[model samples]
Target chain A: MADRREPLHLIKSRRDSALATLVSGVPYLAWLGIRFDRRGDELTAILPYDEKLIGNPLLPAIHGGVTAAFLEVTAIIELAWAGLWEEMESGRIVPDAAVDSAMPRLPKTIDFTVDYLRSGLPRDAYARARIVRSGRRYASVQVEAWQDNRARLLAQATGHFLMPQG
Target chain B: MPQGPDLTDRDQTRIAQQFIEAIPHARALGMRVDALGEGTATISMPWAEHLVGDPRSGVVHGGVVSALMDTCCGAAVMSHPAGPASTATIDLRIDYMRAARQGQRITATAECYHMTRTVAFVRAIALDEDDGNPVAAATGAFTVEG
Candidate 1:
């Protein structure tokens, strides 16, 4: 299957547009201004700094809920991207046709746990999610968010989602 | 505003109201404190189209529920009898019982059930008209900033 796949750049561009469509489908993501950076199959969610995202003016810290929302968005998108890859590789859907069609329904979040390691500074934040386990009925994802220094995580979370069935 | 002292219910309400106003995101979401006590708070936000998660379902996003619960939990800690000046989230766990119905106001109530020298514990529930059925529930640990 790897031998029959499209060239690297072609696949990258296809995934990029597909990811954009998926991200745009959710209204809350747009409201939060959460966007993704796709590097091959890997994705990094970016939250641009906005003054309105502040929860505490005294601490000048970004809202904890905003951070959680960002992390959850990252996990959902990553899972969607992973699922899309299967159909894309099998030629079940063409890049041109896929972009025009409505995106598949997103998995529902069953539960989420977040750990705030440090206060989020008033600056841009980045997050990446790892699919701890993706099964037919359930998926677990772990996400880490960082600002400025990648080594220092501002917050981290784990979420379980109920996957949509066929 | 002394630490480890009982704050009157009226004082708690004032502190919670001021804290909610200071939060830009909470203000953006139109969240307001409905009730406050020694170590508890209840806040509400009216449904808005922009807050919808899935257009097809018209259900509010899980993250929206989380945000409401988180803010309420923090307010509970802030109004605690111990009076920890301020608090920040250390960790939080949220379980979504169901999607919130559209066009309904959502309210979250939280309590600072426990406090230590450096941390406070909180639990909260979010509801939309149906008090018996919660939209979501949360448990969290918060820092007791002196």
Candidate 2:
């Protein structure tokens, strides 16, 4: 139990650190008041509607890139929360810590499919993600973005995290 | 190859620089074309305080990466002598590999895998020089419109 708790604690600390880093490091997201909330296997983020995110000159909708970014971060953080970071740090196993020495080896996205469910209104929007499958060398996740109560976008992504070479 | 003047080294460099200059945010982000030739271009954006998402402490913004990917893909598409000068992204998918820490300059290498008269397919990976590993990877399809 203690051993399990240690890993969990380490993961929580890492997640906290990541959240802090995200909120502070990315200015445009901070400008939009994007915030993250986590619970067990699920992660969610909120982005306040802003005129700057608008793309279309007529309807003034949140840009698709904005939505995609929100989903991407949420999925990555969710994976981190699942102790994937710890698995990466145990260097005897996974060795590539390229992005950050602190971050563990994780898969790179090989493919992603996103669908625009509805036009994101000129108001605050929310996104949530859950791991659909986490295997030895791959993972799939589903994400959705919502404006108010309406589902505005849906996405599914598959990634191939390179396993340590023997 | 179709009959046309092949872009010289100077032509490619000028085209890349012009594309960078055209994007207001890219200019503000201090994006520069370090190299451009054939079907590839390497671009850089120096991290600045204003580019920070949280101004309280300087951390680069996520939107910066998105904008960078957008611009890099466009440049990559145009790097092809036959590709369009202007193109619209049909869809772009970016995977965040890691958080770019404070004061970390980011670099992107974009390449056009394939191109047709009306469409271009591009992919790129961005890294924080401080980390050396990819911070984001993106693939996009751009439609050239007359």
Candidate 3:
């Protein structure tokens, strides 16, 4: 119900932005167990290891598409969060009612590229995103996914997403 | 250098079926092998409530089509006469033409367009009811290694 939607008062930062919580509601994100967390300026995605995500029964690695989707989702979240951060920094006060109705700020992914650096073992994988440049029309983001060590990235992705209208 | 006489059609289908079976995520989305041809594969995914991107619109998510395209491309590589040992997606780019109709089974077909020793190139199209009109199209490269 509109009365029960997440309040926009939480838009102090990307971590608290309504988009962060609204992401969990997306069916694919919910079913894939993709969780978003904010570490300083970076938005990180945690993908729970599931047998259904496996691509090769031999290496037993998570499906490439799964990793790709993870990175893609991270980029969108990062962008939307950044947009909220910009609004907050601008000193515009968004009322609580408007926040509830405008919480789902998902951007459309225009193009995405995912490169497998190594085999993703069957374990929880973490991904972090960096928005290169964002404007009124589009945003470019880079994301990395790693297993045990951040230095040992299993995959990297660069993508462009269409931002919402002015 | 993984090369030999390719797996027979039956063998390829069995391997593809196993590939689909082993991937729990694929099964979760109701993915299945629909057909196979020389250097090409068609995969189908039934629409489920969980696959919807916009709850209000009830349209299938673009990522679902991306998954179908990627998995179908991998299958296309394995069916190649080059004898794909094991392959991983190197890079993929998809152009979403439109959202797929809800409650319809979407089918995707991928073809191995080119291959080298260590890499393979593929193109895929996803459609709902009209085979001529695609909801999305994708191009990507895959790691072809023994």
- Docking class for model 1 is high
Clashing pairs in 3: A52-B24, A52-B25
Model 3, B59-145: lDDT tens digits are 876667778888999888877788877788888888877678888889999999999999999999889986677888889999888
Question: Native contacts retained per candidate?
Answer: 0.84, 0.24, 0.57
Better of 2 and 3 by TM-score: 3
Root-mean-square deviation of every model: 2.7, 8.8, 5.2
Off by over 4 Å in 2: A1-32, A36-44, A51-65, A77-125, A134-139, A146-166, B1-28, B35-39, B48-67, B83-85, B91-104, B127-138
lDDT (0 to 1) per candidate: 0.87, 0.62, 0.77
Assess the local accuracy of residue B118 in candidate 1 as a C-alpha lDDT between 0 and 100. 99
True contacts kept of 1: 0.84
Cα deviation at B116, candidate 2, in Å, is 2.1
TM-scores for candidates 1 onward, in order: 0.92, 0.55, 0.84
- Better structure of 1 and 2 per DockQ: 1
Worst 10 residues of 2 chain A by lDDT: A157-166
Clashes of each: 0, 10, 2
**Worst 10 contiguous positions by lDDT, candidate 3 chain B:** B1-10
The candidate that achieves the highest DockQ relative to the unseen native structure: 1
> What are the runs in model 1 whose C-alpha is more than 4 Å off?
A2-10, A94-102, B1-15
Q: Model 3's DockQ?
A: 0.59
What are the DockQ scores of the candidates, in order? 0.80, 0.16, 0.59
